[model samples]
Target chain A: MLATAAAAIALIFLQQAPAEDIDWDAEFGVEERERDPATGEFPVDPYEKSNANAGAEPFANGRLAAAFGGREGIRRIAERTVELSEADPRIAEIFVAHDTVRLKRTLSEQFCYLLGAGCDYTGRDMRATHDGLGIRTADLNALVENLQQAMREAGVPFAAQNRLLSKLAPMSGDVVER
Target chain B: MRTPCVATGLMLAILSAQPAHADDLEWFEGGKLVLTNGVTTIEGTSGGGIATWATIAGLEMDNGVGVSGHATIIELPDYGWQSHGVAVGIANRVELSYARQNFDTRDVGTALGLGEGYVLNQDIFAAKLRLLGDVVYGDPLLPQVSLGVEYKRSLDGDVAAAVGAARAEGLDYTLSATKLFLSRSVLVNATARLTEANQNGLLGFGSAAGAGHSLQFEGSLGYQLSRRAVIGAEVRTKPDNLGLGEDDWFDLFAAYAVTDNITVTAAYVDLGSIATFEDQRGAFLSAQVAF
Candidate 1:
């Protein structure tokens, strides 16, 4: 009888444990996966769905590349964006020391790579690239406006433009220093 | 009274001084999410239909001011309520609001010896100041906090006296906290209020049964479906000092932003009992325009 009462008391305490103890990911249809016990990090898998580009539509890259009118078309968008940035007073200050032609090429490569056009991005990461520039919200908005205008002039569809912008939006955390 | 009007005049003066482009300063920027900032509460504070939250009224960028106006109508089986108000947010830090509410007694007035179609009018003047944290970008462990006060005055002192009310006016002081989990697209708000208002000051301040204030709570949870739409639920606990057996209030609502300047909200509300009327289920509709 004593042992049975002790087991019953233990059962009640287990039931009263905090709800956060439950593994929510496992309950929410995530596949069974292994994680390092020490770091609680999943093993790196290049082709995993939970990769760096998880939330983006799988076919967005090809669709965006096609929408931007192939390789030459992508290059036109980059050139126009760079030209506008250099002319726009709000953003021109940031590009005063940039090598225009190389910057344009790097932007084109980055855009193509993001759209899954099979091009390698040789530019620095967004955080490192924008570091110490003292970019403000207004400056970011100006840059986005210029990019949108360039895309419009390049004849990219609005939907495709937004698809790319959505992916780029998260980078604001890293790109804006203040 | 003079202060609110003066503030409004000052805001108008500043608005007229700015260029047309400056009006567009309320656009979402720097990781601010659209519609995540709740619309004007019934009392004209920034929040959902019934509860007040800690957020400012507009989509204004940090250090910018935003102003908003709202009109709300609620249709219950036994009563009708309408409210109109204006609110100003300064630097996303402080909020000043004023709302005038009219509660149509309908048949309830006639049954109580008053003429049919009688209306009870009330004025609510409110002010809220953000004290700590940001709802979206501040520390994840801590929510945005604000302290506010609503001074409500009932226009019908005779009616309130007839109903055994102790006073025709009262003050509600509240402390609210709001948090938004951006990645999950969820927002939660909780508010604690100390008040003596009976039926939110529409019936009156305190009742003959009790003149002391009671602590109450209001909470809300919302899920963002898109950049422009949010669906949410709110529950508000009320003080029962009136002896009229008032129950809690509950609502489920959806708000959609037509643009940065305009928003519309519709909800199903259960206000329980009021002044002997039971089961006050109804519909609520509100439209707001903000700069």
Candidate 2:
């Protein structure tokens, strides 16, 4: 036992001697990320952007956009939806680890583009954005309710709200991972 | 014999190799939107007050189990009706339900040589399977559709037979389609049923001669007045097998979601005639809770 203690002390010293030469973070595959100063969002790997990334076709006319209170209203609804989902008990856990700031901006852009409120969507594709989140059908529905609440609060007509829903409803195949 | 033995060994090995995976399964997660599960019908299934829709019975979503219950009352000029039931929804896909219904014959029973205030009772058990589409998702034009089966047993066997009914038990098969066009704030449901029931099996099944299956139709249209309120109307056509002048049924109804889990419905119903009594029109009221 005494010899074993001496050997253990020697092993510790030997391990510490090489610490300065070890690229610990790289060895562990940890990639350091910096938040963009202007956007307060960490950079993601580059991906091609297209309107198709929004996962739905935009409205042909401004009628639907007008009903949603134009670009400002769409932005408000998207931000409010993100806020509500983050606070909701049924789905708060899924949003906790994600950068909500980026989510708000992308969601706002997606909504504005889909509603034809005169904005280009620069967010990641729906499937790529939600990949690996293990989101289930129930989680998708929970987010849908949060969006509905936001739209209702914005005083959008029920029919007009449904019009937007019709566009996004089919994207469940991409958003739901479970 | 060698092949059979090898297959059996393989099956046993596969079964024994399986791991306990209960932790991966989710249960009882209630996240369906308000009133999306629909109200319980008279037969205990999810639907409008008088007709069953393609929607399931509980507030559970695609990965949860949900349960719901309801109590209903209806007043006619010559009779009283009451029913209570419970239902279970599985993964928002399948539903099982049971209901107990009572038909009160205030003075009509005495007139028919039975005691005053005699009541007829029946028990109904039903199961529904959603086949395709969704009420609130996917293609807006493709409505939710389902198939269902209902089994009814009457408590008054002797009375039912005496009243020219072929039997005291029967079955009903139904196919339904429903859609909620949220943009229009309108919801529509249509159902086709094959049945042998008389007065919904409260009186009994079939003709006295034992010949009785018929096709029927139920249609409902609803308009959303608010997030939690809807006004609708329904019409159901029944076979006049008993020749008791049982005319088609119609009702105008309004439903309100009092909370995320409770709903109340009231309607004015017209039954046309029953047991030789004409103009059996009155009021209907129902309350339900789900989670």
Candidate 3:
């Protein structure tokens, strides 16, 4: 009886022993994400991507794009805007823990698409992306100021800068929660 | 989830450990774009030198308080005018202002039998409330609008009576709308005023002839030259109750923000006539500081 009980206990311990140290994440069915090698952005859940996600129609004329220095200039401006916002104390709290790697890429795409620089936007819509972010009007304004500063540094003409602002200004409705 | 809970506890501990005065002086928050506060006018309101705009006088955004002060001088041919004023804006919603205007009758005073250096002074107190829309946001077609009331008291009542002004003190009402066309970099403003004051109350209110009040129109159009500069024109029509040839006023102005807290405006103004002084055109200069 003692030998049979020992064998039974030994079999149960062997079956229960973890093969590796412990993947509590795997045990709880947690999703793991790795950054893309090229883009350096973590993977997000699948969603439909369309040009409508760009939020506004592209400029019919390429004059503004030319003034903005085309796709390269626009991408730089967008990334710089995100960088400045991350550094700005007034709005740092909103960006600190956020996925800025994805932000840089998506923002560049959106700006390039909207400025008529010949790029298709593949990001989610503004409302969907900003949902639950708890952003306020003041925070949005801070972001705009940072964007303006970036454009200024890029030598975008003030009026041309406003041309892009006109398109984004209306989107405050979706982005600002309070 | 455990990590988040631990992070929350750490945040709570740090927040409680912060000094008591860490966030006390937060009322003077400034979040509006540059020059969006508008330049303070001679009347202690945000406007284009002579006309009132719907924008409140402040460097503040919502839930913040701001204050502005201005001193202005309009060097007319026969008379000199100077005004010093201060205004307070509450959360971009309401504004309260006080201005003291001094009309130095230079030679005009002597012509009217008063001393050459005599000054006609008036105190103006005003309050305004924003009614709808925003100056810089929301629908592009919708403009910011406001309603305001002003009470003016003339210090030289006897002299005002001599100039045919019936009352020494009176009330004025104003409704204004202003908009900034961001894409085009243009600004437009219009104001309708109901008043019985003569010369904006420097000559007092109404007249024995009894046209107590009349609707007046004030308009301004501006082009943004840069983030820190704007060029504008204004037309403000006034009542001729005193009949001293108090014709309409017109000006072309350039406003420049020297810094975030300081703005200076220079203009060439045309006051058709004042106290029978015809061809009263001259330079208008003003400096304002806001925070």
Better of 1 and 2 by DockQ: 2
lDDT of each: 0.79, 0.89, 0.88
Clash pairs for candidate 3: none
Give lDDT tens digits, candidate 1, residues B1-291.
678779988999888878855534443332224564578887888899999999877655453667789999999999999999998777677889999999998998899777898999999999999998767553454788999999999998888888878899999999999986654567899999999888988878887766768899999998866557789999999987668898999999999989867899999999999888999999999999887
**In candidate 2, residue A7 scores what lDDT?**
100
Tens-digit lDDT track of model 3 for A5-119: 7999999988855677788998899987788999888888899999998889988777799888888888889999999999999889888777898998899888888888888
Measured against the true two-chain complex, the DockQ scores of the candidates, in the order shown, are 0.02, 0.32, 0.32
Quality of candidate 1's docking, in CAPRI categories?
incorrect
Alpha carbon deviation, residue B13, candidate 1 (Å): 22
Question: Whose TM-score is greatest here?
Answer: 2
TM-score of each candidate? 0.64, 0.88, 0.88
Question: Which is better, 1 or 3, measured by lDDT?
Answer: 3
Query: Which candidate ranks first by lDDT, i.e. highest?
Result: 2
Question: Where does candidate 2 stray beyond 4 Å?
Answer: A1-23, B1-27
Candidate 2 lDDT over B176-229, as tens digits, reads 999988657799999999998888998899989766889999999998877689
List the TM values for chain B, per candidate: 0.88, 0.91, 0.91
Candidates ranked by TM-score: 2, 3, 1
**lDDT value for model 2:** 0.89
